[model samples]
Target: MPDSSTHPTISSAFPLNVLIQGEGFPILCLHGHPGSGRSMSVFTNALSLRFKTLAPDLRGYGRSQTVQNFEMPDHLIDLEALLDRHQIDQCLILGWSLGGILALELALRQLKRVSGLILVATAARPWGNHPPVTWQDNLYTGLASVFNRLNPGWRWNIDTFGQRSLYRYLIQQHTPETYQYLAREAMDAYLQTSRQATQALYKALNQGYNRLADLPKIQCPCLVLAGAGDRHITPASSQETADHLPNAEWRCYPNTAHLFPWEMPNQVLKDICDWIERNPEVISFKKPEVRSRGQ
Candidate 1:
């Protein structure tokens, strides 16, 4: 349950939904697709021990309002507002899944506001295309289509089977309200992103300006976290992203899935904390020149 003693506040910058705690330089937590910030609580709670953490439900997820006309750039605008609201000029950013896209975008564009970056199980490539020779894509698409028809205007309760089943047990740990909030926000994210975001993403597929190509442009020291058993995003994909970056380090957690942050929070936090310690200057100071993608 959320701390009722401390009221939840809303921001007008995409009206970001946020959870703040701890002490030290700020660290913004961005969750992946069909995900709310709450999903990464396992990672956030531990990170809070070393740094002030702010986990925001990305635009269109959780309490954040969806933009009527959305675009890739909206993500940056929302993060900008968050930094301004928190009076944080610069901070470390950690993103998982779809949140990793936003993290990369912010690091590339608003480099001045971000210091170090941690990308968990995310690829530099636009993940809009169906995987070649894999029935998984067809299965997921077919299921999504069926769910879309069954639950019109409902975001969370549509498909309670396939993908939902994978995380059901973990979700059971949360309070009823928290679970409901997560469910509703997931539905909203699916609905809001399925059209504009998804189309724009596919359009970018095969283009040279993808996550992989953009890595060398990021001057900040990055920690690329990947799971060995991430079937959706093969281990090779993680290695490829690491290979392109100028100064990126990688750590693989054995026997883990795409949800490594939640599944193995301690290791994830240690990796991030260790990286920040080794590169202390990367945080708590201005290093805009570092992020220029000078190619």
Candidate 2:
């Protein structure tokens, strides 16, 4: 097993905490909303054996410093700074949920720097045409508004039936042991996240963020993984994303929900590894000269 280490990149606004492991072609792992770099360990740990993995706790999530008001572009800037600081000219990106959206945007912004994309349980445009704000959204937002003002670290108790039900919805297929383990970890990451950050992200998504038109512009190889039982981001939505992408391979896992990575870690890992092996071009991708800002 490859050992992992957490390194903090100091920035003027806030420090970005990254978990790095292994030593080979770089693979940047981006976690979903309300998740931390720790949330991506299941994939990072396994991929680390063959590729260098850099999983960062995005600003306002996990160990990273919390910011009061920020937008999605802030994350993009952080990612760009991270790559520049590490001096990584090119790398493959594995993005889960919200991270997947960011990955797409990054690939678009840095076409040459991003060799390929692995999008899991996410969509380029999650809300499609009409974005609905559910009761759950209200609940979290209301609670966050109250709790965040008092204390950002304060978290809602997971023992409640409502929280339990939400967990079940997020993770439908899981063994008793796996359920217990993932539930605890997921809740911790979720609760630890800045409430303001969640609100901002939700607001951004609700504004009808759609990338269907831009998908065709992303020419890099892509592997889009979806969970058939995912209610949060339906498999159909994922399929639509794949359909629009110029070069993409789609795979949907049966009997799994949004948290399929935790439910079926081995299978997900195998699929990713197998895909990489089959697509050797992803490994031998040539790096282009770094362009200066505004080039």
Candidate 3:
């Protein structure tokens, strides 16, 4: 639960449902594809000791209203509305997986509004460098598309057993029970959406999204964090992105995969706060110290 009295907010005009916490240095937290604000809420809550956190469901995911088109620009428009609503001038952005790409784009589009960036499991450009899309990816999406064509209602089904199963496979956590707990939390959070919507978001974000040339154009400092075991977006991608950035640092957690928010919340918060401390331009003043059960 959020400590902020006015949190778990849903904007009437824009309909971007958000969970706001902490009191200083607003940091926007954007969750990955097929994920909702609750996906990152755990990590954001951990950071409440240091920086203020704003975790919002991307358009069409979680409690936010479904968008006609789930494109990168559509997501950005919602983010702009968030900034305007909060009256925040510029703050750091912490993006996880797909959220990393959005944070990079936000910094690229509005450099002044983005003071710093923390990209976890993100890429720079030429997502083509990864091996060709897996057959599993194709099969799941193809089946969903086929089902939706046959029955439009199938596209909006909330039973995300398949999605959660795939996530368990991707997130190589400690135990099956722990993974199940994490997956169930996310499944409950991802209400009112479908696999077709997931495919649409992946397509929109991946299409023509080569930003190698634009990486150098970013004026703010950046930190790229990756998981050694994340096959979806590997460590090499994070390294390539960090290499292209003028002021950036790259780090990878051993034996960890994607979904670091759930797998390694403490480490994630520590690195993020450390990066902000190095920049010193962000709002949080004290060095962030977070403790984890196993860490």
CA lDDT scores, all candidates in order:
0.65, 0.77, 0.69
Model 1 segments more than 4 A misplaced: 1-13, 126-209, 287-295
Per model, how many backbone clashes are there?
5, 0, 0
Model 2: how far residue 203 lies from native, Å: 1.9
For 104-196, candidate 2 gives per-residue lDDT tens digits of 988877877888999999997674322365777567544533433343323353322223344545666635444444544566677779976
What's model 2's TM-score?
A: 0.81
* TM-score of every model versus the real structure: 0.69, 0.81, 0.74
Error of 2 at 152 (Å): 25
- For 57-162, candidate 3 gives per-residue lDDT tens digits of 8777778856465445557767877988898878889898778888887787777778888898888652423345577766664453344334432314213332
Quick one: ranking by lDDT, best first? 2, 3, 1
Sorted on TM-score, best first, the list reads 2, 3, 1
What is the TM-score (0 to 1) of candidate 1? 0.69
Candidate with the larger lDDT of 1 and 3? 3
Give the top-scoring candidate (TM-score).
2
